[model samples]
Target: MGIEYKRRYALLLAARDSEYVKKVYGGYFNVFVAAYGDEEEEERWDMYRVVDGEFPDMDDLQSYDGFIVSGSPYDAYGDDNWILELCFLLQALDSMQKKVLGICFGHQVLCRALGGKVGKSDSGWDIGPRKVNIVNSCSLFETLFETLPALTIIECHQDEVLELPIGAEVIGFSDKTGVEMFRIGNHILGVQGHPEYSKDILNNLIDRLLSQDSIEIDQANEARSKLEIQEPNSKCWQEICKAFLKGLWNEYPSIEQ
Candidate 1:
């Protein structure tokens, strides 16, 4: 073999490791690792609970090959100290041309950090499995476009990217959300859905949302019903995300390649 190399990735966890997540998925970190990590490879992911004010040091930023921002219960537009700090961190990552992937709250926050507008959706809350139509605008991901015309992903968010950042472009959309996915050149990408979520996790979350009065009984039931029949293309999404993070622009190439 010529050489052995491994790419390091960090998960900027924006939510607390909930009791439910821990009980069901062995913690939120496990959930993300299960979704995006190569289990056979021991040296891959790092976790930082940013919601708890934990973050990777600035000097160590160059060590990671890419970063992933997890969904949060908190508003991305809020002026909390940690949120501000995370925004500054994101700006620095962008400047360094380091790859960053944002999911849900991460998506909205990245937009906010990079000169975009985000707010509560005028169309209201979008919960459960949603089908996102990939747009053909971004030529940079032609292979991804060719592979997946549309993808169904687990969505649970009220905030959205209303106006894209200075150089961001919408690459995916859904009926409920205008900006389902966006890209900033090749280094940054944001997705408004939880490709990491499993049906059981979403079901548990639905129950919690119902108890908290965040979603109506009918809406929750409808979302569950759809999940009974439709499966989100988690595999395809994993490929796309891994490709972007690994700096593969060809055809959603595998990480090992």
Candidate 2:
């Protein structure tokens, strides 16, 4: 038998695992893997806690087939040493045409790194389940998903992308955020919501935000109420993300129909 090649992927975690997440799900790494990873034995996923100054060696970057940047509590526009280094690393990854999937703060930072604009949302925080309208003109979306006009996702962000990078296209948007999702060519995709988050995780985060006084009591209450009414299209979003990262859309029979 011919030697089989293993597919390797990396998760560039940009946030610390909250105590609730640690205790409940083991960690954010496990949460992400559960959402986006294939169960095949030949696939491997590695995590680098970029929030804590950990990163893959520059020379080893190409060994992985894809990279995922996780949501963070930090501002994507901040000039923290690690943030600057991460921007540089993203730039390098961009030049190499590597597949990169950015979530929430990851979405914003990827935009900033690629010469786009990002800043605090004038509309304030967007928390809970939101309906994001998919752009029908996006060939990528057409190739991957059925003719669904929109998808609901859980969002928790105070920052948003004001302008897109050069040559970038907005693939999804919502009533609250204009750039709910974007892409640069086929190699980079950025999503403003958390597809990997479960309702419990978001509930825990909402409680944490209330405890920290980061959000007003009324806002927290409203967010929690909304969560009870709507549900995120998590499975659909996960399928889209996995298809993008693993290059599985080409094999999708929908394209031939």
Candidate 3:
């Protein structure tokens, strides 16, 4: 008899869920599953709050087909112990040739882990629906994103990837940040914006940021106004992510040395 197997993925979350997410979305794990999982496919997703010291065991790395890192409030370049440990974990994933997708802080940390540079953005905060230009479209993602010249995604970050790892290629960028999306080899992809976020989620985030004084009231209002006027291309971003992780691209160049 043939055995049935299902694909599995991991979420290396770098932050704790906000009370709002927990209450409204049933936590960040569900939010990710909703964004990345195929409703028809019998795939499994596991969450590991790496910020809380939970990580997949070294022996179980092969059990997962891909890994996705979640955004965090913490700075990617911070010298915290957990951040360093996450870097080591990312390096191990790269060595194993496992697919890893990073978002927001995840994007910055992946670059740092792979010998790239990440630091505070000199242009200050980038909030709201930001248009990211598709500078290079390889065969893998061209048709998947419908060949759009630019895609807007929700952005809320103060740090940016200053340099890419040696073989990493910049596939997408924005007016505020140079490196919006980067791919390393066939296994690693990083996106600087939040594709999983809905307008409501971003609005909540803006409110929280304002309450904490991370952003001024004027900035928050402007971002909220933009959200009301134009929506981010969430469907396109989700498809790009799905294609990248599901190995839909037939002719992507290898970034490996």
Candidate 4:
């Protein structure tokens, strides 16, 4: 079946990329990306500008078969109202039985909306790729998550979900954080790792960070060093992506052949 007739997915990208223009998943999936934040990229993420200081109900969102929440530099625990709204959006998607995947900050949003709490990490910043253990097994994780061993994931974050939302299940974790992955419902999945990000995307993020003076030179270098050591996508990325996409396919097979 053609992508036009296939499942429609929507990516809520919190971070914008400027240097990269016109990039997509490069697959059969039909999805639209919406970026948030004041940071601008040479290539806009198709972010919606709220003139009335309120976001409209995007029809694409309502029809989306799946949702992917991208990582962000903003903290979910902050006083920003947008972050709170995004959290509610995630919960709404979950309640509607839509497939949702949250990465990094997206992961924290999932936790917080589920009656969970988010807080600063006492273990310091987590930079680079690291091994994450699958906490339990389920169909949502059948091929992708269940029994996955020490999968290396790209990570760069200082805050974590200190508490789990009510009825939330922990899918994976590590020594640094108690919950590495979680799911609110059967079809919703939230991972603290960046499985969809290529090293190039990470680089764009770094460039934006540099321009914004978000991180000192030494800190950026340190994180870059750690990212290399983490060696994201060293087979782990491909496997995880394959598993994740496959899981989605299995969940809702295309209507056409």
* Best candidate according to TM-score: 2
Clashing pairs in 4: 18-41, 18-42, 135-171
| Every candidate's lDDT | 0.88, 0.91, 0.89, 0.62
The pairs that clash in candidate 2 are none
Tens digits of per-residue lDDT for model 4, 1-257: 72343344455666544435236443211122322111222222223322112443744566555666666777878657677677677777777777767778878877787678998899867765667876546565565444345666777788899998887888788877788888765666678877665566666667766788776677678768777766654344434432352244244322210
Question: Going through the candidates in order, what is the number of backbone clashes in each?
Answer: 0, 0, 0, 3
Q: What is every candidate's alpha-carbon RMSD to the true fold?
A: 3.1, 2.6, 4.2, 7.4
Best by lDDT: 2
| lDDT per residue as tens, model 2, 56-84 | 99999999899999999999999999899
Model 4: residues with Cα > 4 Å off, grouped in runs: 1-4, 19-62, 136-147, 207-219, 234-257
lDDT minimum window of 10 residues, candidate 1: 248-257
Model 2 has a clash total of 0
Query: Per-residue alpha-carbon lDDT of model 3 for 22-115, expressed as tens digits?
Result: 9999999999999988888878888999999898999999889999999999999998999999999999999999999999999999999999
- Give the range of the ten consecutive residues with the poorest summed lDDT in model 4: 28-37
Ranking of candidates on lDDT, top first: 2, 3, 1, 4
lDDT, residue 212, model 3: 95
